[model samples]
Target: MRRSFKISFLLIVMMICVLSGKCRAGDRFIRNSAFKGDRQIIVTFAGPVSDVWANDISNFTVNEKPDPDIMLEIEDSTLSLDKTSLVFTFKDPLNREVPHCLTLKQIIADGRSQGTATVTLRKNYLAHLFSVFLGAVLIQNFVFVKYLGLCVFLGVSQKKSTAVGMGITFTIVIVFASMLSWFLYRFVLKPYHLDFLQVIVFIGLVSLTVQGIDTVLRKVNPALFKSFGVYLVLVISSCIILAVPLMLAANDYDMFESLMLSLGAGVGFLLALFLMASVRERLELANVPTPFRGMPIAFIITGLFALSFMGFSGMSLF
Candidate 1:
């Protein structure tokens, strides 16, 4: 009993460290702007900034149009020492209907000159949503692009019907799990600085959710449960299942963006599974070489799929 307790305690500590480590943000520029018929735009950076960098109108440019109806004149520029943000108030209020572009020639931060920070000011929320969806599905696909959740992708993709079932299950679970994890991290863990416990908390939430799903399936349709019971159980430990929430936490995506990302990832996983299953199903009839018969052929096909997905690299919605 004492040994078991010690093992459990070590596991808990490890989980805490993992979760806390996951919450640490990386070096990246976070941009935010506000327009309420006001000419002021605030651009914030979550990273560090050097105090020696000049904060002046000469350092920034607005509206790249050669000949413009409305010219953007920077009245004043202010830099936050603690927050590492730059705020600019324009002489004229920006046109909300038309998109505006701004460029910072040199943003020296952390003793390093960030050569250029280009920002496009567009309040098109729908476009942003579509971009997020497209990115998640194609560019950053969980399986092909990100190489996540391969175990389930390869294991249950032998048949199209089974692949579709697993895809649906994954979609439902991932979407719900991401949203739940985001709420927990944002409200409960982050506020209290208990983010170190995120790994354990997220895994616990996912396991409970998968269990709930299994219970429901077993009760409502025993035949279906018998068919895909093992796959459903395996989802609790699926890397993709955990990855979605971890990414959401790391990127600090809002609720809507997180939901879209989860949905896109699920759809992308489903698409890959379906394609692989169809290809594998056809391969069974083909008289292939003995060396490249089963798993070998599957891996080759997956590599081809990954290559195909590479076409979406650097694709931008805007």
Candidate 2:
């Protein structure tokens, strides 16, 4: 009993450390604030050994003298594995409280040739919100550009009733997934330097959470579940349930940005799915060649729908 108690105590302490930020996965122990200067750069490695080849990297002004107003520091740890590559980035760290067009890229390798690239920080709140609205609606539309969740898009879209049901379902799942992912990331994986574990962790947690929610709903509200239970299985298969949360976590978005993203993504997914279903319902009677009967023609129509959504670009709605 004493041995077991000791082990349990150690585990609890480790969990506390991971949440408290004593350790971290990415480089830059400090979260870079939007300071008056050019930019801030940070790089991390897989293992304790220094492996970043920061030479020849362009697009930033280099200083030959002492460290400029901005500087980078490298640390080595012997506890990490050397195989897999991991990258953790926030698209809008400067204006994380708002929204913006953010990009994060990380490449991991064995040799000393591993690095990450992140750009597009929101300068202020107004610009970030505008960009977020516009980007969600049209530019980085969840359906057209990313081709995220399409199974339900073409499945439950036959009737207006079913479409509404599926839309509500999608929104709830996305919101829950996004919130859960952010919690796991901010509170669990990130501090322990286990960011590479995101995919498996997210999949397992989302599957379990959705299943638990489904069970609870079935027990508490049988009628609603009966009406939408058919869609639960479909929702589990839809990648958007997993993708939206992972995207928000990876981007390090604030609560508002994450919520906006989830809502916008849900809308985009619903729009595409409903529109496709409606058009296909009408196209059933249209004349088509034998080679393009069911799926072939559906694909053709989907391509057109994607093309049409592109016209909403350059419009700021946020």
Candidate 3:
């Protein structure tokens, strides 16, 4: 009986080893590929794997270069168990237009051996910047697309000069406020789980920023302030001003991206204001029915502008 039991135990161990080997052989495959930013490349596997061997510099190649560049460092590589992903952060930004290939040879994950997985990095910062700019100015436009800041858009856009001033002011304020709000949300409220206070905090921040700008403008350019100071103060209540920080916070954009978005939004607002001011100026001379002369005609023109901006939809730089 003892001899038979020992033989059975050895047979079971051998079967287990074979099964494990087969499992490892069949499970090696790439799941997805993406970029963290302009530099870091993330490659995910279908199954979990040991990153110890995979992180080696010799195991990876970029652009099929036979001789690796001295600038490329292996220490920048990282592995995440939670997502079953390997991250390779390049020391510098890769060329945007060129198609770059990253090849992983003899990579092992979840005790399974993967032969080779190659991922092409096609995303670039310029494309991303253009996308952001296009999206903000056209697709998700602050005034026409989103219908935000209508109060100032219609009120201040009565004249080309006022429209220009308001556009500049809105751009400056939006950029500064969005950046400051990002820092506050990322570093303070988010870490402490004080998200409930976001609205109050954002409103307060925007009000203070507008007030600060108003104070400075009053001192620096009294004539300009006298002309547009009321509108600047009124911006404290402008939905666009408040919406910028809120949108940035909600989207969880980084500092640079938030700034880009703010600038885009500002420029879009400026464009809308300028366009509307120009149209209204022309409308003054056109013969129109008395019933549709002022506000009605203005609304119709605004709607037309909105429709025209819609043509930019589905347009992307990437």
Q: How many clashes (backbone N, Cα, C below 3 Å) per candidate? A: 1, 2, 3
Which candidate comes out best when scored by TM-score? Answer: 3
As a TM-score, model 3 comes out at 0.64
Across 153-257, the per-residue lDDT of candidate 2 in tens digits comes to 766766767887787787777777776677678768988999999899888877876787699789989999998777777777888888877887777765556
RMSD of 1: 13.6
Question: Per-residue alpha-carbon lDDT of model 3 for 241-298, expressed as tens digits?
Answer: 8898888888776555677899999999999999999988888889989999778888
By summed lDDT, the worst window of 10 consecutive residues in model 1 runs over: 21-30
Q: Rank the candidates by lDDT, best first.
A: 1, 3, 2
Q: Candidate 2: where are CA atoms >4 Å away?
A: 1-127
Among residues 3 or more apart in sequence or in different chains, the pairs in candidate 2 whose N, CA or C atoms overlap within 3 Å are: 48-76, 48-77
The candidate 3 region of ten consecutive residues with least summed lDDT is 19-28
Among all windows of 10 consecutive residues in model 2, the one with the lowest summed lDDT is 71-80
Name model 1 segments beyond 4 Å from true. Answer: 1-123, 220-230
